[model samples]
Target: MTGTEPLEGAAPAVGAPLLEATGITKRYGRYTALDAVDLRIEAGRTVSVVGESGSGKSTLARVIIGLERPDSGSVRFRGEPVRGRRARRAFRHSVGMVFQDPYESIDPRLTIGEVVAEPLRAHGLYRRDGAARVRELLDSVGMEGVDPDAYPHRFSGGQRQRVCIARAVATDPELVICDEPTSALDVSVQAQILNLLLDLQRRRGLSYLFITHDLEVVRRISDEVDVLLRGTVVERGTAEQVTSRPQHEYTRRLLGAVPAISPRQRRIGAPLISDAPAVPDSKESTESKESKESNSA
Candidate 1:
């Protein structure tokens, strides 16, 4: 996902990526949160970034979506630099985000109609028909016929997440950075949300930079996967290649750590460098990426 090279025989990405981050490094004091990280998301594809907690996954997510800027790197959306007020405003409208917790992300004071229509209002999109568009988005996320005047607290967790999805896609964003949007839900509800996201992606052609620690979820949803150890990417490939045939010790250990529910759990053997010297933990730092928030819902 780092390189800009096109696949053999495949046409070029045309002009530039829908979204690209290159040589991204974010440092807080002596700690390097992101170490020369690079990621590219093409149109209509899901490139999942999978790592354990504190692996800088959220930092990367924030940087990509314009909530935070890297200390030494560049982020481009549709070939436009995501800097300055004007460019950032354009970036926010082009990209949407779904946070990990639906309840906390939505404002308690806002009704479902307001929550979904907020993005439209921010971007001045669908202005005259905002209410109709909100209903369409709600219906699209499987919350049709519900009272748009209802508050966030009245909805169940899954229902709230549906509303979140409706808001995220309200402005017809080309890319969506989903930061563990399903991790907080029950297993059944998680499945439902995942399916809804996939359906929306299919209908809207929305690219996704899905951030998660769950390898199982990655395999189910991602076309390509990046395995992050600490902060840097240790392995990258198709979901089948990276998950089933991991080439890094850290990735192998992660695969091994997954819970086995059956007697016949498949084993992913260690890498050839299993006996090699242990790699040092990435010199990473942590800070809230929520500062300098964009106009996303």
Candidate 2:
């Protein structure tokens, strides 16, 4: 069940775990979205779930974040079981999420500042400081230049992502789940957002469950990776081991698909290899040139 924002507020306990999920499993009809998944985050370590489309990466994230309830698993916060009324109250303040689609995830009705402060208002994260806290949140995400009053539609995709990040980090959340946070932006912009997230992590010591289809992205931010295939984890290791010495067949297949981009494919897609002159196929080019000369002769 998708959770509605919880009602009633409580003071967050002092110096406790950011978030935790253990033995998480979810099913839909005959299919399983997540099959007995075990995931953990230290105080400030990032764990990335790497997989392609429909591989249950997103489902695991949704379940862990309390967007969906697992069939039989427990989510914990600060070494306490997160399955009761008090746990739900703590979760509202302790966890924040940056969704894949920034455009749809942000409300168009609210100004960027309003959007950023929504969680703050929802959980009383900034009930006292108010606008000052909002500005600080914007600056924390490298969006201090943008006026809080501006509409989200006015911002570029990368900038929209910045707003999303600002909103996620507003409450100084101990844990943030980034769901393909850069997949919708230009390559250059993707780099900027990645850097921003890294900077924030360094400054705040925030832990993350980073999810993405991009191996290059996983390499940059992930300390460890869980390779999910058909709702099951096929491989789990450090990013270096997974990228350099893949063990699973699915992992190897994904590694093989990473194209060594040509100068052309760097601009277009991976088909630029076909457009290049090939050594064996050069015979056909030579024949065509001779044919042209004969016609001229």
Candidate 3:
């Protein structure tokens, strides 16, 4: 389809996958980053790709999002090939991405409002009420009181990620490709961000292609899971099926690597450490006072 034509006007046929990649292969000289990889994501669902570093998870995301082209195979969005500059541009309006490092993803020089409004402006979706839209986006992502004029450096990592998320969804894209979006956040903050993403998906009917090495995260957010090892998918199934009943040897090993505390080892309802030292017993205090008096006498 041409760029001038509203790509969103042409909807996918009923029952067709939202996005499909078939036999995608990528080579960097002799090194193969992806080997005949195939993936499909449905509407309003999460499909997680789990793998360690250099296992082609990021490569797959990039290829599907048109950041990097595969050597072979094809990426089809809404049943149309994402080919040529115009087509890729059209495809981008329907998709968005959130990167692994929130700090690195945003430009420090730009104000938060500018960063969030960028996608809207780029795709010609921004209007006279764009600033108001920016405020609404920030509020939706849990940055309600944040100053829009503030720069990226002023925000915490988690807060910056929220801004990135706001930017990603500014265009109201059908799918968001999150490439390790929570990997760099604190454990507690990770849970909050995950929840926010889930909430956004439910409210907006957005789909996610979540990429992460953490199987724990997959279990938490994924509807389907694909295990990638050495640039090849070793297993693919529902999140429950792959996590609880993994058939692949590599998948099992990956699951085993996740640290877990046994019920016996967990310290439930433990008190937080206090800054003040423990008080001495009455007997010890009396003895100390008596000793001091005797020495003075």
Candidate 4:
């Protein structure tokens, strides 16, 4: 089968979600990392989960990817339970992950070619033309003409992230879970990586479970958004709805925190600093102090 086609028996049934989690809960000792969260992704679209740090965004990604099994609830891929060894192995082949830190995600010991080919080799997809396939994947992510034999450390942060993205799509998976994929890059580089993701999604017909703390990113990449706060989803709606007219207090706070490109571009009624006090002038302070003293007299 070609890269564009879904894997055999991996396609979802009609009207079924590509991936779904219901009432997911995870705990470590007495602390709950995830509290009864429900999320779903549709085919060929992006679903983003947005929250602050420690809000269970990564935990949800882990649970959905089977890195950590939830204490309660279930995850389904293609409308079937992701349980048992065989089922999980199959599920993994159809899902790829781009982790937050590029520096740590790739092995320093391996060459770029080997890093990208690891998934293909693991899934038994690497064959006679595997090297060429690896090169093709690298080029797709704008890494053309670089020697694949070079170690990951030789590349810049943005370059390494491009490599990570190449590896994520090497297997031509149906879904890619991006955990803060561009958070570590510089502002300009972040735009490039996000555009690459959008391009890949269009070309490969891939779905995304995009997890980020940045609401601006949600505006750019997501079709639907789920606002996660302290392990629970406080709001869910279309990307525009959640970002532009957020109803939940937590979601509004998150949007308010995003730095606008210019003061004029900031949302109407959304201040540059939310609930922040203005710097007091020395003259104004003295005048107010004198006024207070005279009033007391």
Q: Evaluate all candidate structures by whole-model CA lDDT and list the values in order.
A: 0.75, 0.73, 0.80, 0.81
Candidate 4 — which residues are off by over 4 angstroms? 1-14, 260-297
Looking at model 2, residue 209 earns an lDDT score of 90
Superior candidate under lDDT, 1 versus 3: 3
**Per-candidate RMSD, Å:** 11.8, 14.0, 13.9, 14.8
Spell out the clash pairs found in candidate 1. 32-284
Worst 10 contiguous positions by lDDT, candidate 2: 2-11
Clashing pairs in 3: none
Q: For model 1, where is the 10-residue window of minimal lDDT?
A: 283-292
In candidate 2, how many clashes are counted? 1
Cα lDDT of model 2 by residue, 1-117, tens digit: 222122111122234445657778798987777777767677887878888898889999888777788898898877788777777777757777998877788898999999988
Model 1 earns a TM-score of 0.82
Weakest lDDT window of 10 consecutive positions for candidate 3 = 1-10
lDDT of 3 by residue, 176-284 (tens): 9999998776554566678788889999999999999989778868988888877788788888888898877778889998654233323572211121112112324
Candidate 2 at 185: error in angstroms?
A: 0.8
- Ranked by lDDT, the better of candidates 2 and 3 is 3
TM-score of 4: 0.83
How does candidate 3 fare on TM-score?
Answer: 0.83
* Residue-level lDDT tens digits of model 4 in 101-217: 888899999999999999999999999999999999988887777798999766767677888999999989999999999887655456667877888898999999999999988
